[model samples]
Target chain A: MSDLLERLRGRGWRLTAQRRVIAEVLDGEHVHYTADEVHALAVARLPEISRASVYNTLGELVALGEVLEVTTEGGRAKRYDPNAHRPHQHLVCSGCGTMRDVHLVTDPMGALPEGERFGFTVSGVTVTYYGRCPECGSRA
Target chain B: MSDLLERLRGRGWRLTAQRRVIAEVLDGEHVHYTADEVHALAVARLPEISRASVYNTLGELVALGEVLEVTTEGGRAKRYDPNAHRPHQHLVCSGCGTMRDVHLVTDPMGALPEGERFGFTVSGVTVTYYGRCPECGSRA
Candidate 1:
């Protein structure tokens, strides 16, 4: 069982075979897959998994805070990120939309002063760094 | 004429009545409207404006680097941000999806150490802060 499956099991989540396979597919470093991508991957493994099941499972995982939903670009498909437990930001390649997990040294929330709060109780922050990866740069 | 209209005109962009109304709707501080919203606003000014025109104009503006596209949540509508000329970040209200322009004090690029680059030539960064605004907080 994957770490996500174990965590879900610990939380008393019912472990269906379909859910197990989807969780297994999501367990990895820097793994970010769109719904269609996840459905395709799950279909390759289980062959009977439906797209609706994949979408529902992904939604449940996100609602449970076990998965993070990320959108690097507007009008693009949302990607499912399994690195929710780890504290990190994202570095995206502008050319190919490739994203990698990056750890930042400074507290980004601290950069927003009180005057800028605008009476909103700020809770969280996400920093997305954009650039061309080596492959794209070389190709360009 | 709005600043965006002036800039577009200076670039030799042909200004139609529909395009002028759409650009006027997009000109303001912290103005982030979706294509649907832009169409609705433009229709108020030009009754015959089509949804296709609004989307096309937005695409052209984004391609021209005069407007920025922003998506606050996965599976949500993409918002067109007109503050492309200014250097700033975004603060989003998690409850109502209201976004405000925010200026950060520190250079976020500096926080990413060289070892974390993973061979990607990072050129730009966007930091998005999420929290509930005063209205939502009070309602809660």
Candidate 2:
């Protein structure tokens, strides 16, 4: 959105064409894309966009708290999500790499007993559940 | 530890010196070492351990279900842990990278409401809490 672009400009970020394309690619519902994926998508719109530029823009967005970086199991490539305004978890499809947002109705932090604090303040908690999707399961 | 090596060998893994040193480096209570950190410790013993070997052995260990690879908040180098027998979450110190195992008294999976399943069978869940350690807190 223009508001997001204006906020980035206010943060002293250079509003180049490459950054704009990356931002546009990331703005949507259930939009989770890797850096390389974003680069591919951005290149479709702006042919001159480089992979390094996509990586840089995604890193800056994460640092600015406008995006969240998710590293799934097996040390795969990090995925970027722009839905940082709301708190939620992810349900990833192991077969297709498709990810869907699942908002937790019960606060996961509330389950942490007081005895396990270990003198450190608990700031936030994230939960990720991995499994086969319905389509994948039917195939199995 | 000999029993573990024997089980690993039974799984068709070659018992090489590089693998031995990597296993020893990860053997202990509450030990979580990154790949480079494991390489540093492995080299101290074998002196010929390559980063590739450390990576290979770690991957093999995870496949064998003898070790767990943990990727904390954001995408960082994966950390290896030898405690595969227990069900626990991590309490990681954002400052020192110190990790402690904290058992959740409540079943977090059970807390997920039925409507949020998204038709995927949840296999497992991992929770990580990030905060400053006592030393880091005092410095701040």
Candidate 3:
């Protein structure tokens, strides 16, 4: 059983076969899939799973704060991130849009000086590292 | 004349009446507007301008590297950033989605260790700070 499914079940969320399969597909570190991709994976697991079901389940997970919708690249489809409990950032490949979870040495929120805050009450930070993966680098 | 307009002119970009109005609306240090917002502003300036024109112009500017498309909020509409030449990150309001350009003291790319890079040749980094602006904070 995936941590996501376990968490959902703990929250008294009714896990239908569709929802369960969707959660299972999203189980792992560095797992980020767009809605369509999630639908495809869920379909592979349960051939009867519908695209609308995947989208709705994904939306529910995001609304429940169990998943994160991430738009790594501008004008690109948003990716659903299942590693919501962990505190980490993303390393995105510029060439292929592949993403991986990366723990940073320093918390970016701490790096902002008071002078740069511009009168806003600061809370959190997101740091995205852009690069070429080994495959893309080798190709280049 | 705005820097963006001047740069576009320098590059021999045709400054039609519609394009000029759109460019003028986008001129600022922290300007980040979605296509709909940009269209609204452009309509205020030139009532005859169409939404498609604004989208097309924004696309061309992005392709020319004269503008940047930024997504401050996950699953939200992308914002067009005119300050593409400057090196900076974004400070976004979690409550209202307001965003401002912010400069950090340390370079984040330098903080990633070689072992943690996971075989990716990291090149750049984007750091986004999330918080509530004064208006939203006051309401809270």
lDDT of 3 by residue, A1-140 (tens): 37667877889999799998888888887898989999998888899998889889988998998898887755278788888888888899887888988888887877788988888999788888888898889554
Supply candidate 2's per-residue lDDT for A138.
Answer: 40
Docking class of 3: medium
Which stretches of candidate 2 lie above 4 Å from their native place?
A: A9-14, A138-140, B6-17, B138-140
CAPRI-style class, candidate 2: medium
lDDT of 1 by residue, A45-82 (tens): 99999999999999999999989998876428889998
Candidate 1 or 3, higher DockQ? Answer: 1
DockQ, every prediction: 0.86, 0.64, 0.77
Over B13-122, each residue of candidate 2 has an lDDT whose tens digit, in order, gives 78888888888888888898999999999888988778898888889889888999998875388888889988888888877778888888778777667688788877
For model 2 chain B, the run of ten residues with the poorest summed lDDT: B131-140
lDDT of 1: 0.88
Local error of candidate 2 at residue B46 (angstroms):
1.7
User: What lDDT does the true structure give each of the candidates?
Assistant: 0.88, 0.83, 0.84
Q: Estimate each model's TM-score.
A: 0.95, 0.89, 0.91
Model 1: lDDT of residue A121? 88
True contacts kept of 1: 0.88
Cα error of candidate 3 at position B14, Å: 1.8
The runs of at least 3 residues in candidate 1 whose Cα sits more than 4 Å from the true structure, single-residue gaps closed, are: A138-140, B138-140
Docking class of 1: high
True contacts kept of each: 0.88, 0.67, 0.81
